[model samples]
Target: MARRFVTLDVFTTRRHAGNPLAVVLQAEGLDTEAMQAIAREFNLSETVFVLPPERPEHRAALRIFTPGTELPFAGHPTVGTAVWLALHDEAEGGGTEMLVLEEKVGAVACAVEVTGSHAGHAAFTLPRLPEAVGTAPAAGLLAPALGLDAGEIGFGAHRPGIFSAGVPFLCIPLASRAAVAHARPDMGRWQDALGASAAFVYSHETAEAGHHYHARMFAPTLGIAEDPATGSAVAAFAGAIIAHEPPGEGDHRFVIEQGYEMGRPSQIVLEMSVRGGALVSARIGGSAVVVSEGVLL
Candidate 1:
């Protein structure tokens, strides 16, 4: 039987300006190999397979994948998959302010607010509470992997670290947005240095551009060289900040700007707070516009 899939460009307000994703609906019987094949066929950055919920309280079970491998959890796939379900009327809409989505990481709560006409898409928030895993990375090895000079990297007195809300990324601070924008992954070195230690290299600049930082992600491990907007990485970045940054003088919420270097121009909002010893209620959310929707066949 021929399977069907729908594609969308995520994170950007306009079409064709963000990361592209494919959603495979009615994917109940497909095995792992079949799913991977389907994802490769779409050839998008990521593809989501929607499955029936194991429990009645949850909305759906989402399986996320890049072209190369299946992921336990991902940022855009979670958001895009929810939107896809809402658009197809598989999940409820309009009546409820929040929806709970089950992924491999755990159950996540997504809040959707319809900001436009009923026929148009709505913006949603992902609960992105992430945790800091380690203190810092070896600058000697990491800087060159991102094609940057050691002086071009920023330690900010906090040091580079490993963080994750769902998926882990090594958050590296850069001296300038230009450095981040010019980043090209040195795959061989990155593989040798990172080597299952990190799934991606998230380079960021602090110069605000309608957001707290301009960022880019290079995951040769995942077959992606610079993701336009990384929801998971943004969430992890926020978590890392909360763990490292001094007590805020003001609000903690901020936006992440990414994809400009790649010409896609994407934005991700990272929302979180610190309570007790752990980072509580971390959410990574963003907007996505459907660029095109057609059957795979």
Candidate 2:
């Protein structure tokens, strides 16, 4: 059988600058093994298979897979898929539409902004709130793992910790952008320190003047040595920000710049609402461009 697929650059308005994703449409009969095989064949960070929604009202069901394994939920795939669907399925007029997509984690409600027939942006509220899953290894243990000194391992009130919205990541707060740029992962130490979780290293200093943070992600266990843009990581990062910054009640926003070191510059916008000194909700939004479409036989 031949499956129609679309390739998109997620989290960037331009092509070839953000994380690339392959979305297979009309994916009805493909089994789990076949889907995993297809994901491996794509060799991207993630591949999404679109199926009929189990619920009658939702837009579709998304099965997200990394090269090595399936994920319950992923950021770029959700954003890119929502934009692609909105552009192709909706009438060509500048307006916003709401879409519900079912994933393994839960149903995600996405607000898609359409600008034209082919260009659109999408944002989705996190289906699950991020929480600290566990504390990370001490700075002494994590320093060698990330090729950083113990002194460079943390920032004010932010240290190494594990957090998850739907997916878990070991969030490491570096001292500066220079440190984030200079750090390298030692696979041996990484295995010892992080074990099963991926590492999300970030700094308050950013490469872009307008951006609020700079970041890099390493997940060798998922066949991703480094990821250019990671929405799920940013989704979970809301918790870390709330813990450290503790914004006043009401809505706040930040732009995160990532992937500059790898040459693929990408931007992710994070919005959060707080009340009573607690984070009430959060959303991840970004622009995506449909680069190409092909039939996979």
- Using TM-score, give the best candidate's number: 2
Q: Give the per-residue lDDT of model 1 (tens digit) for 187-218.
A: 77877667654433334455454567777787
Q: What is the lDDT of residue 158 in candidate 2?
A: 86
Predicted structure 1, TM vs. truth: 0.88
Q: Which stretches of candidate 1 lie over 4 Å from their true place?
A: 90-95, 115-128, 134-136, 197-208, 247-251, 276-278
* Candidate whose lDDT is highest: 2
User: Can you write out model 2's per-residue Cα lDDT over 85-153, one digit (the tens) per residue?
Assistant: 898776555334899999999999999987655668999999998998987798998899889899998
Clashing pairs in 2: none
Candidate 1 residue pairs in backbone clash:
127-283, 128-282, 128-283, 129-282
TM-score of each: 0.88, 0.97
